[model samples]
Target: MRVAYNEQMNALSKILGEMAGLAGSAMERATQSLLQADLSLAESVITEYDQIAALSHQAEERAFALLALQAPVAGDLRSVVSGIQIVADVDRMGALALHVAKIARRRHPNHALPEEVNGYFAEMGRIAVALGAAAQEVLISRDPERALRLREEDEAMDDLHRHLFTVLMDRNWSHGVAAAVDVTLLGRFYERFADHAVEVGRRVVFLVTGTLPSDEDHEIDLAHGR
Candidate 1:
């Protein structure tokens, strides 16, 4: 049964890896849709989210069942429990990706955002991709320190996001209310994407330390304009 339990844990790891990959892809596709006004790609990512969620649910259930049946102790238990925590991160990441897709779909019919904002959107996509990649590395290596480093990279996205608002909120700027709303939502989507990335980093910390962080642990990254 020990061998069986070990095998189950390995399978869980594989599932989590796939989940992260899908989430990363979803975010990439969403960004392309937003940057290029590709409604079809946006719609596809949104529609595929159900599958992502389903896979996540399955991973959670398996992790729980392993706990209940195998009653893993010591390192085994830590591995199983940490795997569960990672699944939660993956699920949230998937949701963040789908959220971006929704914003893209809504902004369809309009041309892609102005050239000034495209680079920021691309930067956001880079962060989202990094977040998933970081999570996967943490899971595979159980390197909490590496995951913490990845968390710090989220600040880059936040800085870019702030710069975007600064450009849009200038007194002389006149993108109009509708365009402004779209831009605001796009910024929000990117910010939340980083937020989810931070959450994944927190999960990694939890997995390593076996302790969850408090709300006070978060450092606000909002721009001065807000």
Candidate 2:
């Protein structure tokens, strides 16, 4: 019975990894479409959203089934619960990517961002992609330390987002209101995508260390002589 239970856990972990990869790839493609005004690539990201959603549903189903059949205890139980939360976070990440793609499509043949601010969006996309990659690595390695370190990446995304607003608010800004709206939405999509990746990392830490992120932070503060 124990052997069977472990096998099921392994299978669920594999599914979660695949889901993370899909979300990351979707975001990367979406970023390309947004910055380059590539309607075809945007369409591809939008089209693939259903697959990401389906994987989340499958992960939830497997987790519940494991609970019913295995009645997992301690670490196993944490794994099942965390698996559910991780799937939710990963699924949301994919949806955010789809939003980015749709914005690109909405403004097809015309760049969504002004030339002066284009570099800001590019950097935001880079940070978001890096966070997604880190989320996948933390999940697979179950490294609590790596998971905790993702918070810094999230801060970088936040900084980019704030910087974007400064550009938009400049009195000399020439882009019309419609363009500003598009940039606002695009910045939000990237920021939220990074937020979800950080959430996934926290879930991984909980799964491995059985300690919530807040509690882990408290411990770190104590160790640092704070």
Candidate 3:
């Protein structure tokens, strides 16, 4: 029974790792579609999102089954609970990527981002993808230190998000209101994507240490225009 329980727990980890990979790839492709105005790639990101959702469901089922069958106690119970929370974070990551893809699709035949701010979105995409990969590593390795390191990369994402607003609010800005709205929403999507990755790392820290970070040590303020 113990061996069976261990195997099931390992399987749950594997599913979560897969979900993280899919979510990260979706964001990467969605970024490409957004920058290049590639409808086909955007459509693919939209379509493939179902896979991440499916895996989230699968991971949840496995976690609940472990809880029911094993009645995991102490650290084992923490692992199961943290796995459930991580699933939610990863699912949100995928959903955020889907939003990005839809925006790209909606603005097809024309770039959603104005030429001046394209570099900002490009760098945002790079940071988001890197954070996702780091979160995945932390999940698989269950390393609290590596999990904590996600916050450092997330700081870069926040800087990019703030820079986006600086450009939009410039008095000399030439893009119309509609373009500003698109950039604002796109910046939020990437910023939220990075937030979810950080949340995943936080959950990993809980799974390993059985304690969450202090509120002060947690994610940056997500308030709009902050």
Best candidate per TM-score, number? 3
Positional deviation of 188 in candidate 1, in angstroms? 2.3
Q: Write the per-residue lDDT of candidate 3 for residues 79-188, one digit (tens) a residue.
A: 99999999999999999999999999999999999999989988999988898888888888999999988987888988877777878888878989999999988988
Write the candidate numbers in order of decreasing TM-score: 3, 2, 1
For residues 78-190, write the lDDT of model 2, one tens digit per residue. 99999988899899999999999999998899988788888988898888888888888887888899998888778878777777777877777899899988988888888
Report how far residue 183 has shifted in candidate 2, in Å: 0.8
* Best model per lDDT: 3
Question: Which model is ahead, 1 or 3, in terms of lDDT?
Answer: 3
Model 1 clash pairs?
Answer: none
Q: What is the C-alpha lDDT of each candidate?
A: 0.77, 0.85, 0.89
Q: Ten residues in a row with the worst lDDT in model 2?
A: 217-226
Q: Distance from true position, residue 170, model 3, in Å?
A: 1.0
Candidate rank order under lDDT: 3, 2, 1
Between prediction 1 and prediction 2, which has the larger lDDT?
Answer: 2
Stretches of candidate 1 off by over 4 Å are 209-223
How far out, in Å, is residue 20 in model 1? 1.2
